[model samples]
Target: MRTALLLAAFLCGPALADRQSFPPVDEADRDPSLVEFRETLLAKIAARDVDTIVALACPDIYLSHGGDGGPEELRANLVLDPQTLSEEYREDADAMREQYWTDLENTLSQPGYFDDEGEFWMPHQWQITLPASLDAHLAYFVTGQNVSLRQQPNRDAPLITRISHEVVILRDHQSSAEYQRVLLTDGTQGYMHSDFLWPMTGHRAAFVKSDAGGWQLCTFVSGD
Candidate 1:
């Protein structure tokens, strides 16, 4: 009876108003608690806290001196926790959805979306499908280049621009649509097309600059 009473008292104890939000410790500051850091990062992104992102991210986050296109472009790459998003963020998500749908509608309503290149296709803009399945989250790749990889869907154009954290592929005949996309870690997805992805049957995707650039051999579905 006494133990039960003491437990009840502990449960009913007064809440501490002075409880720290994030723990202030050496490890917390230096090592950065992953969960807490992720949460805080998402929260700041949701609120468009560009200053916080600039402070937290490495010096070469986007490689434009941390002040490239500012918060708007940064927010484009950010996905927030659905549970914690503010009403404004909810509205923003809705807007993004609306924009995507609008773009799709515009493309589909064209004179010949599937056949006519000049009618439906625009330079430097594309809507390639993501390679891997994603959850409720939506993602897209935008090129800073003018020309796409397709020379009528089966040839390589000139190297337009350098894509960071991305690999380029040369187009050739006998390429398959299934191998058109560049796979990503975390089972997410990336961009590539039959026009750009050089197919190698029974061989994993390899990065080679000039067919010889910064190359890294990857092992998918293999325990490394």
Candidate 2:
């Protein structure tokens, strides 16, 4: 008897599915290494912590994902020329199953690539160290949807900081509204929205820019 082999490929971008190969990043993805304490970053974004989110990303970070038409396609979905999504999309269990199966079928039908688990890299911690004079903390920014930044500690920049999802900075201080602020990375602080920011786990020291953009040590919020 001949048996058909089922090969699965995971696609990036917003296409949702259940057996769709790569599982969507859930609460687990935000733990320990990624960046902010999952909840606090959420609070910051709900609060609109603009300055905080931007401070956490690496400089030269550009967004990409599978399923996207391309980079520009994803950017069009994220970059807010006017507005952003207000609530998280909670897929109905049955609907998710249907989408998952459909995507899974499409993925399995394609020729599979050899993925060596050992060759794959999983980040234990994502960090962002601002220039000596910037006053702020670091975080993870998810590009595409809204700028979802998870605030955390420092890491080397000028490299692609792989995350489960693409993110951007939150520059506000309130704990409920997604604040607006400048993200200090890639040698410049770009403007980002507040909705997408989340807090990384554990507290780390940070700096704030003086009137002259000089770093002065600052205190981290309790959950920061």
Candidate 3:
């Protein structure tokens, strides 16, 4: 649990015992320091507080998708000064900032974007690992058929459970294109064929921290 994140419930489940490891993140892998910064950043973002946002950001922030720089670049892009904008540039300027912030705000609401080093490490475009205990908040139903919750990603792995049609399979929010990793209510974690599940609205976050104790948000994105 974290100072800000204590507001949410938590989960505990078994690891997917599959051969093909799911690429999405997991609750077990999170860094509390990163999670705290994420929650605080989200609050500041909702309030549109630029000063506080920059204070928590790394001066040399890395934007993998957009401009590759730090606070200077982020502030330049996000601060939409109407008086400075030319008539023609006004529309695109506002839209660009809007889209950028919107995407980030959306991304930060999900989970499992951080790596072992307490740094954000989502290499893929869209991925989420459901929070360990918050499965009740978002889940997927085993659709149309009885699906085997496998111990591993492959078909040969041992079956953890036989899921029936519309059975609410609590997702760990960890995802891959082919197989989605999930957890049973009984605390058994495993993989479900991605095709057999349906996902709901979920939120996740990202971070950038240096060894010298600089903790801040790099970016945030949300997915299905």
For 72-124, candidate 3 gives per-residue lDDT tens digits of 66676568666567887876887867877775675565444445555664322
The model with the greatest lDDT is 3
What is the C-alpha lDDT profile of model 1 across 85-189, one tens digit per residue?
Answer: 567677577566455334323322222111122111211112222223232022222222322432233235433232322222222223345323332222222
Error of 1 at 78 (Å): 10
Alpha-carbon runs more than 4 Å astray in model 1: 1-32, 63-224
How many residue pairs clash in all the candidates, one count each? 3, 59, 23
Q: Write the per-residue lDDT of candidate 2 for residues 128-205, one digit (tens) a residue.
A: 222233222434333223232223222222322223233223345455443344343222343334433433322222
Quote the lDDT for 144 in model 3: 34
Runs in model 2 lying further than 4 Å from the true structure:
1-137, 143-172, 202-224
Error of 2 at 136 (Å): 8.5
In order, what lDDT does every prediction score? 0.29, 0.30, 0.56
Kindly indicate the candidate among 1 and 2 with the higher TM-score. 2
